[model samples]
Target: MMANTNGYLVGSNLERVLKAGHFAVTAELGPPQSAEGDVIRKKAGLLRGYCDAVNLTDNQTAIVRLSSIAAGAILVQEGLEPIIQMTCRDRNRLAIQSDLLGAAALGIRNLLCLTGDHQTFGNHPSAKNVFDIDSLQMVQMVTAMRDERTFQCGDSFKGPEPRFFVGAAAAPFADPVDFRPLRLAKKAKAGANFIQTQLVYDIPAFEKFMAKVRALGVHKQTYILAGVGPLKSPAMAKYMKSNVPGILVPDELIERMELAGAPWAGKSKEELTKDDKKARSAAWQAEGIQICIELINKLHQIEGVSGVHIMAIEWEDAVRPIVEGAGLSPRPVVTESPPLAAALG
Candidate 1:
């Protein structure tokens, strides 16, 4: 593990890459439901070098999975940096801080604080939740831990404190549309160093949102990484557009996905053979990747966007082509700098 001698918070690779002004790329790595380190290692192989760092989701969707910190440690061993996600759904402040210390001890330096999805949506629908603190408070808690070397209760650490490059989520098109920007401002005010947004398919809407963001000057306070992903099928696209909260998939993109299946457009399920369905699936995926590449290009032109977060979800292989197609391959490597105090001297 590298020492905290760099003139940056935590000195994580993600922070350095963004500080260097590179349009950074980050991807999601969903840990398996079982206790298999090999699953994480295999996913790391797919993302290594294609992104600055990969986010290990913390029991995403409130389902049980290999712990994010544990999966992150595996990523660290694989020579890939990890952004460990900490959710407020399952743990209280004490558990959160303890796990954070464990993560930092294991060489993980990036943290994404999230108010996780409700437990009713997951397999454990009857499970009790522990929302001791929301994401905003979680951000403030970690920030205090890193900056002031104090616990959430304001108690000073007896030993070296955990340092992190803290992150929070943003949803541009969520409900109360007019207030999304203000919600983001609150996160920035709470001390988020970076913001990874919800999936953005409605470019025009996102542009309008950024207009407000820039007006409030939140972008200048923290780095914003636009989230993107490849649609597996037209059904998948439609489902997200109609069902998912905070995600707005444009009608044109859904139409594009539908058009990709033009060959079997009117065919009934019984009429379509296995091979026909398979072929159509491939075509839709190809179009999806192309669409993602185009979105990345457009996002690059958006003024406040610092980079992109590709949420390829379960389809890790799509990241390579999507990144390469967008001409963001061969990611930059930024060397470490002296600590802040030493640099000041």
Candidate 2:
């Protein structure tokens, strides 16, 4: 893989970027399957000046998606940081190992290891399943690469081994309270450096999740970023309810959307490009932003919590206002790139 193409030194290296006391924002954008690289590129360009880093989702929700690495290369070329999302459902250890090395060789630093959605959830329901390993093991793999400078299973490296600022995902609102903390800790123990959680709707539930995170001391050990998505319309709300797992929309939010005045229930909420006012009026969009910032401002003051990752699906353009409105400044500390990091092993 080629490296040092642009200013995006390492997308996986945000672990190094995050300061203990400061709040940060990493936005995500999903790629379209068709020849729509421009769509993602244009959005990334718009967000270049706002988000600390932009995440390219990999086949989000088991649907066919454009290659995140390729799309990420485009972002990096445009002088923006790109966080590469890697899912285990699509590749095995060999493929993952090679890809990690290739990514680092290409100077891509950030990596989010996920045990992607089941094949049944995607467009192709008949495709074969590959649970060859899970997200927990994937953490161990990256951790081993970092600490031991070798493959996760103990293979020696012919050249300099790869190291990734590895991240993992969790849904505090997903399951029972009894097992959620344990599962999150397991990934950390297995070697996840950062935790980017599943979408959170209920702030109390998130606070409860934080309590568990604080109780276990993992909050101190890992960088936890609260994930958020703005409800575009009641139709979008309905989609989340029927499709997304581990996400809960508050009755109040739903009520507000359904009970919203004419403009919200119409196409304005969905089509008003770069118009924050439209989303703010009679919709759950502003509520989502305020909720995220309120929680973020609180998270900033929390003893162990670090930052927040805003997943503004198609609303990347609105991130700056939301963040600036919250009074969190975007301070990107410039670090020089290490001499060309790409040399195939």
Clashes of each: 0, 6
Give the per-residue lDDT digits (tens) of candidate 1, residues 102-203: 999999999999999999999999999999999999999999998888999999998888999999999899999999999999999999999999999999
Model 1 C-alpha lDDT versus the unseen true structure: 0.93
Model 1, residue pairs in steric clash: none
Which candidate wins on TM-score? Answer: 1
Worst 10 residues of 2 by lDDT: 336-345
- TM-score, each model? 0.96, 0.83
Residue pairs in candidate 2 whose N, alpha carbon or C atoms collide under 3 angstroms = 10-109, 11-109, 11-110, 12-109, 12-110, 13-109
- Model 2 clash count equals 6
Runs of candidate 2 with Cα error greater than 4 angstroms are: 1-13, 238-243, 259-292, 298-303, 334-345
Give stretches of model 1 more than 4 Å off: 1-3, 336-345
For model 1, give the 10-residue run with minimal summed lDDT: 336-345
- 164-283, model 2: which lDDT tens digit per residue? 677898878776767888898887887777788887767777787788878998876677888866666666767787677788777776665666534534555466555655454535
User: Against the true structure, what is every candidate's RMSD?
Assistant: 2.7, 6.2
